[model samples]
Target: MNYFITGGTGFIGTHLTSLLHKVHPKAKVYNLDIVKPGTPLPAVKDYKPALREGKEHAATFIYCDVRQPIELEKVNITPDDVIFNFAAVHRTPGHPDSEYFETNIRGAENVCAFAERHGIKKIVFTSSIAPYGAAEELKEETTLPMPNTPYGISKLVAEKIHQNWQASAEDRQLTILRPGVVFGKGENGNFTRLYWSIRGHRFMYPGRKDTIKACIYVKELVRFMLYRLEHHDSGVELYNCCYEPAYTIEQIVEAMKRVTGMNVNVPYMPGWLIMSAAGALGALGSPMGICPARVRKLQISTNICGKKLAASGYHFCYTFEEALADWYKDNNNQCLE
Candidate 1:
């Protein structure tokens, strides 16, 4: 059976492609994304060709945007083909609020519609814990989504759009995974920034050390996704994809230090000072992930629960420290390059 991955050129998508190659060596995988294979995104410049070396030649690249009606009439898609929906504008404080809904929500609708037309039985959707809100509460699969940001709201709506498609057919299978902050080699997000900050001795606690950030290694997340896709139960199944006990800011920092052998003392910086510095930088701070919105995010805890994923019988391949170490090694002993 062939595999189709939307947003397949992205950080998580690229890692997923690599992992799929390891598992299914001769798999006919198609990467459908707006970004071409050779062109790496500016933010994720470290995304190297070596990551998809052997698999790159095998997988087909399709230039398709999910926001519009997916025009894949020429491509051969069968009922057994699996579709992974990873398309979305996920970055916070990066795009206009309307951009989130325009891309994420419309993308989901179009993807589900395409699935219906092709009679694709299996679909894997990568959602976010942002739907559960950014509060310090422990979010579970059953938690009522109270999305505060446009991205979260769009994701939530997108989840329902996929769910509606699933409900239309009894035999169709849907696996929705709401992942936390996923970090690994190609991730240019929070963890990468943290690594750089610590290595450069510019790391400082935003306000408190106890702020919990639900996170998972990219490889581990991909493994779980594959496991579910291979041995999925009938009908719709949802899970919060994160470590069982999420790590606090202090714990995460300590893990990074142990893995990278960098133990510069990190002092807690006052919230007011950070805001003042951000204000002084004007437009400069936004691009550096230091704006007011991102600063506020640093203070809030994304305490998402992962009991369902844990109970799925999929063992975590890497611990927090081990994951960090592997990421460091993968990036040639650098901050994931």
Candidate 2:
């Protein structure tokens, strides 16, 4: 069977594509994304040999935008193929309020429609834990989503769209994974930014050290996704995709220091000071990419729970420290390029 991965050039999509290429070498894998072939994420670049080489297993890149129904209709897909929907405007503060709903909600609608047209029965949707909002207590799959942000609201709505599609047919299978800050090889996100800050000795604890940042390594996350896909065949299933217990910002920094042997000399900065500086920068219209609202997240705890996933017999392949080491190794023994 073939695999259709939307948002395939993205951080998780690229890794998932690579993993599928390795496991199902004979299957035709199509990576549908808004990004063109030549411009891929750094993680995708690492798998170019296996993904773009003149091999049967190499993934085919298709320039497709999920927000448009016409663009999805252009893709040649069969009902037997599995679709992995990873397309969304995920980054907060960077996207306009309407862009989140436009891309995420509309994208979900279009993808579900495409799946219905092709009679595709199986779909895996990667949603965010943002629906849990800024919870200090650990959130689980059963927790009522109290989304406050536009991105979170959009993701929650998108989940319903996928669920609605699955509910239409008894044979259809849908797995919704609400993953926290997923970090690994191609992730030039939070973990990468933290690494640079620490290496440069410019890192500082923003107000609190114990702020929870629920996260999972990209490899482990995809492995779990595959495991769920192989283990479950029908019905709807939802799981919080993260480590059992979330890591504190302090623990994260300490793990990085221990794994990479980076000197930990960061001092705790008052939250008010950081907020004021960020606000001043924003008021002055400075090109400094610091958003006061985003900076505020440094102090907020996103304590998400993954007990349901862990209890489902899916063993974690990497601990926080081990994941960091693996990520470092994957980056060619460097934190960032």
Candidate 3:
């Protein structure tokens, strides 16, 4: 089997690619990213060497921009390949919203077009739980997408691109996975930000601590992706790829306290105070450049329902507490000290 992945250098992509290589030793694994495999980043030193170790020895690295048309002459994307579209401008503040549309939306369309034209058998897309927006209750796949931000809008648009392509093709199989905030090592998303805040001893309750955020560990997410690929009989399925039990913000912080043994100095800062402070900071544009937009995003609830996915016969490997403990165990000295 041959597999091609966009954004293969990303946190989830790297994990999934390495696992796939290990599972299928002889399979050709191609990684497509903006930077060459051996390129260095500030956060992770010798990232390329780390990515190339063990399972990825036989992996092929291709540096290309997916937004533009594929240069078949340079790197041939064949019909026999299984494509996984994991490339996107993921959560980061202050990034221009247009970048999300160009990359997430246009880039996804390009992938779908390439897959359909080249007769790729299967394409797995990584969608986000962001599309569900801030729901009052737990959200399901059947829930209407009411994306508030440009990032969420772009992801939903990208999902539609795959859906349209699947409708056009007769033999093609497409699986869309809407996973919650994925947490693990090397991931610096919302969950990581929270972990860092706690580790730095700056943990504070954001208004109410009852805001529930559905989460999935990297390992379980990869398992679900592999399972969906093997069980393609479902015919273009959309699964909420998340852990069975959700964790409230307070519960997660408490778990962090247990793992790190850090002094929890949570202050009950009023919501209005936070909003005002954020607004003032936005106006002043301090050295750290805190903004009200970011503050609003931080406060939004992202709870989701994973019953649909559970009913599909997928089981979660790590419980919420186990995942939290593993994260602390791995990064305790650095983050929890």
Candidate 4:
């Protein structure tokens, strides 16, 4: 078996590629990324161990932009390969809206076109929970997508793109996964920011402590993807990849305190004040790397139902407390005193 992945150097992609190598020893894995292998990239260091692990086992790396036209002759991509589309310009508070549309929307179209042209039988796309937008309770797969931000809108659009392609190509197998906030050993974005802030003893809580955050560990998400690959007959399935139980803000903070053994202060800033501050920061070119659009997200619940995935025989390995303890133990020295 041979597999081709886009954004293979990314957090989820790296983990998925490593697991694929382990499970399918004779599989030929090809990773296509904007950054060429052996080149300096934003999060390359985080994926070093995974890359080395792949090299020790057997994997190939290719540098190419999925948004652009692919030279199939040069890359040797054939109809026999299974492709995983995980490349996209991830969410950032201050990112230009054009970047999101170009990469997330147009880039996804390019990948779909490539797969369709090559007659790739199976294509797994990594979507996001953001498509369901802010909800008061657990959102299900049948809920209408009310994307609030450009990032969420783009993901929803990409999902539609995949659906259109699959509809046109009856032989193609498409599995779209909408994962919650994924965290692991080398995670970045929200998880990294929160981890660093808590470790630095500078963490602060907003007014309410009841806000729930839906989350999934990276390893568990990868396992689900591999499971989908083995069960290709599942057809065009969409599953929410997250833990069965959700965690509230207070619960997460308590877990952090337990793991760090530090007396971290949780300043209760007024909700209005936080929103005003976030707005001001966003207007001033989005300093602090915070996205103004996500300010509302701080107040809303992010719990999503994963029963559909569980029904597909998927199980989560790490509990919230367990993951936090492991992270703290591994990053004790990086924490601020």
Instruction: Give me the candidate number with maximum lDDT.
Output: 1
In candidate 1, what are the lDDT values of residues 53-120, reduced to their tens digit? 44353357899999999878567788988999999998887788999999999999999998998899
- Please write out the lDDT profile of model 3 over residues 124-199, one tens digit for every residue: 9999987876666678889999987788899999999998888885777889999987877667456766766776
lDDT of 4 at 141: 91
* Candidate 4 or 2, higher TM-score: 2
Colliding pairs, model 4: 93-291
lDDT for each candidate structure: 0.84, 0.82, 0.75, 0.74
All candidates: CA RMSD (Å): 2.3, 3.7, 3.4, 3.7
TM value for model 4:
0.86
Error of 3 at 66 (Å): 1.1
Name the candidate that leads on TM-score.
1
**Candidate 2 local accuracy as lDDT?**
0.82
TM-score of each predicted structure versus truth: 0.94, 0.91, 0.88, 0.86
Ranked by TM-score, the better of candidates 1 and 4 is 1
Query: Candidate 2 residues 1-337, lDDT tens each?
Result: 8788888777788788778988888888888887754453443223232123342324688878888882544456788889999988987766779999999999999999988988999999999998888768778888899999999999999999999999999999999999988888757577777887788776678788999898999999988888988988899999998887888999999888888888668898898887788788888863334568767877889888878888999888888889989988876776642
| Weakest ten-residue segment in model 2 by summed lDDT | 44-53
Ranking 1 against 4 by lDDT, winner: 1
